[model samples]
Target: MTGRHAVPEAIPQESPAPAAAPAQEAAPGFSGRLTAPLLIGSLLNPLNTTMISTALVAIGHHFGIGAADTAWLISVLYLASAVAQPVLGKLADVLGPRRVFLVGLVVVIASGLVGTVAPSFGWLLVSRLLLGIGTSAAYPAAMAVLRDESARIGRAAPRSVLARLSFAALGSAAVGPTLGGLLVMVVGWRGIFAVNVPVALVAFGAALLWIPADPPGRRAADGVAPRLGLDPLGIGLFTAALTVLVFFLLDLAHPMWWLLAPFAVLTAALVRWQLRRPDPFIDLRMLAGNAALSRTYLRHGVSYLLIYCVMYGYTQWLEEARGYSSGHTGLLMLPMSVAALVCSLLGARTKGIRGPLTLACVLLTVGAGVLMFLSGDTPLAVLLLAGACFGIPQGLIGTSNQAAVQAYAPARAIGSAAGLQRTAQYLGAITASSLIALAYGQSAGDHGLHLMAGVAAVLGVLLIVLTVTDRALRGRT
Candidate 1:
């Protein structure tokens, strides 16, 4: 369970849906009780994801597994969610967000229940798969709903939407770790999942009443219902390619040598098929057509990779290595996450200025560099200082980059653009986790920090090159 804040400027580039449409017209803000329920319900998405993160040790203890194996319990959920999101966004566009949102809650509730009571590791993985699928449905649905809500409110929405979304996304991010820590400390890991089951039920019930349906488009008759005609062969091959690819990388030191050949072949095949298909799963058109948007996507990918490696690795290092309580580990991460949200709020204020892009590049570039420096055996005060400098700036830069991509995307492709952008993020997280694991393999302490520093340096150089070559961005603000 994990979530990140949505950047400001997440609007649909094209004419999304006319305001008259059911789903197109945003639901009115409720007066009292509905507001709190809806807000809390919407937040469950983030809460569920982030809760499991700090609870890994408890999970491992329950299953009697090692850290490496338990790590997959987290990583696999992200992998499945990333792969499923683009497809789910298309469903949201067609079937209507309200429908998808409800479905997502239902899936989440069931998965949470399963995880809460699961008897074995195999069942736990199965439950995680269900959770991933549910989560895939929520992000797009939430974005679409927010977009519609903004439409009803006119231009004032995006300004405030960041805070609202951030509160849900980043707020939940901050809360999840702490709450998860508390839950694990109390009843165990299952208690974390147990809590989610009730929350999901409430969200589902409220959504059924408060969320509205969409009017029909010719292409979207009956609300983007799942089709039997989906290309199973292509999807299977693609999923297999990603699976083998991840498995191979995650086991780099051990090297599943034979899996590499199949992984390569399947990846090539998936690429070829995607290129030929009229409706590709990867939405290469959105990715390839816009230079700014594409670069933003890449920037986001690199940034997430760097962020997750340090944040995730440091958590385990804090708890397992340093003997901090889960609560304290969560507490330690608070400053960075809070700094990130604060930076986002500040960045949102400066949107559309010419300097935003440059400011973003500078912030992330320097932040990445600083994080590299702090990754070593730095003193606590020095590390905290680094967190303030780096976390705040990167938070601002990350959302700015996201907003830029959405701002520049082609018409009618907002869903693809958003989904693709997020995919870049998840891909980075997944890659970073594997790479950092490989780097840290059996090393005593802080040895892997250098590998990440190398990554930060390389990304910083690339950002500089890209910023220079793109003349439109220079002094454009």
Candidate 2:
């Protein structure tokens, strides 16, 4: 949860004052100070997520765990982040994005410090939990902050703002594995976490200097405590539903498929509870009422499921089965990131969502189909070419889907809508992590790689079909 939902009447309100007038700031597309720091802050989340991909094999070796057991490192972070992003977004709205953003940076700093010296896998897991909760704040809060600026200035959000945010996220993710590989070789696996400290500090200092303070009277009355507005019952039910679902998928290789019954029951109960609540943590009603919004959410989820499977699953296979050094693997993976960066920049000129989405699906299918041919002896050039194929979709999906959701959602609920989009993406990530664990129970061999690619191909096909059939995506915004 990133930004605050609408407050109930009984609850105290932020000051009714209008935002400060925009200064005669001069920047070609956006306010440089604001955009630069926000972009830097946003980069932390995706950078950390993908950097860990390259370091996973080393961490597993150090812990003496199999590939399946080691996957918890990735899954747990996404799980925590999936739940945290919207909550923090809500907090940002209630308190202030500046305060929440600063708190998140502090948490990240602390997480990095703890993770650097952890002696056991459990301790590292704790750090990742902190990282997940901390890093989740920046993007949604950034969105809220930008929206506030737009309203205050009597202008729409600059197209460059969303474009830049999307670029930073995907660009950072594209570079993370290669960067992590180099860092692993130079300073060992712990460098992956330790490196966050300095970068986060820079972002903190920059944000403190650049991001504006909230307007006067923009907080709950000091004497009277503000209501949290969280539905404890709904949260419990939703958490249980997601927990059981993820666990069921993770345990698919075992006899725990029966857990699906409880998961279904919990999901139904959650929907019922949310429908009745005035301020549910997750607005199930909105999702159900808005078909286009719902489709965007599902599409984002499946798109991420396919990408992360390749990002993490492929990296593991390259190292363990193909005998490539982490550094070499990172280099080979560069084509995907570079291609994504290029395509994202190009795709920004596109007006409607359909064209980019269709291209994304096509690229994804091609990439996944190519993966079917991967083997221990696959040519390096061919593998790099395949990585580039995957990269094109990576670039397109984030930008295209973000635009679609922003266009489709109601004006007042944009914050919640953005949070939901992140939730969907992270949920897909969690599913991908579980699938990775199941597919590569021991090692990422030919069979596992082929199966994962097939899954990606299926997701790509579904996305293509959705784009073709969904009218919402066809019209210009």
Candidate 3:
């Protein structure tokens, strides 16, 4: 935590004239002009992730496809995002975050338009792929922008600012199903995709107006020769490895054990190739050295894994097992969303990481344990109470782990580090989906829900152990 406040390498050198001082003086803080655009941009990925949940049925019916075919619509985005997040994040670090951020929004707008006019299911898949790549850029780029702002202001970013980001992401995801359901009812499945156009447009416009321009010759200013060493070969190998790994994870119910062989080979090749490059696509050496940041990634992934399991699994159980309608299930889950929002706001006001993180882990474990007691005969009050238990941890863990990453990552590579953080979360989400499928089989039942909960409880305990044992996080804010 000693260098947690170190100025980012991308910060521009100040001019030696007194006249240039006024411009620096006029620069806005995190809550000033930067807030709206950054928050709006960061919400896109999670919003898109869950928004389609309610629209899947309509989409499958329209395309004359089964659940298996429509399943690709969901898997494709996770697959594309799992690869694109790190790639775009590295680009944000090298090419400048503002430039990358704006470009990503443009891509998002384009994807929305593509989806709106898509002629077939194949075209829709293409749209989702583009959406994944586009949305993946926002979070990492926003983190890099925050780093730049912090360096310019000569202090660490407030925990409240990070909390606002968590709020936006969590809130948008929670509302996505409701929004998608309304959109589908009003304008059909295309509305789900078409909706991105206006949102991206507004975000793009706000970003252009609010986000400061990147200083010229960033690499040169840092005393390195300007070069775009993107390492295409290394990127290819990483993508190949990740794609294979995701395919393997998605098929865990049947266990496609053979895919592991190619995944291992590609990973080995990627490691070997990256180690030799001066500007690797992913800096393995850096990750090896920064154990605290690495742990933050692990914590983030595991936390999200448990959250997604409960979110999707619990919802399905309420619908199929408890015989609740989709509308009723959404209403029942409202308590979770409300609790998460409140806890996120509360968690952000605290400066210490360990306290909230430990509480979140404890609550998550307790919530999972409570899930085992759920039955069709369970009272509505008890169901609502259970949702709130899980929601509290969702809010606390997201902000605390995010703050931990900000505290531990190297200033020079903050963008890439943020990207990898997101990649970990996506991997966790994919794993959750597989776990749900394995447990629930053809339909969500009481036994399957309890089984998933048991696994989540175990992971929750592990998260607590990891959080309490990490000495690096002891005094980190």
Which candidate has the top score in TM-score? Answer: 2
Top candidate when judged by lDDT against the true structure? 2
Q: 389-425 in candidate 3: lDDT tens per residue? A: 8888878887777667667776555556667777888
Off by over 4 Å in 3: 1-20, 26-34, 57-71, 114-122, 144-163, 181-189, 212-214, 219-226
Clashes of each: 10, 13, 0
How well does candidate 2 score on lDDT at residue 431? Answer: 85
lDDT of 2 by residue, 327-430 (tens): 88888789988988887887777877888888888888888899988998898888898888888888888888877776777655566677788889988888
Kindly report which residue pairs in candidate 3 clash with one another. none
What lDDT does each candidate get?
A: 0.63, 0.80, 0.78
Q: Which 10 residues in a row give candidate 1 its minimum summed lDDT?
A: 1-10
What's the true lDDT of residue 194 in model 2? 97
By lDDT, the better pick of 2 and 3 is: 2
Q: How accurate is candidate 3 locally (lDDT)?
A: 0.78
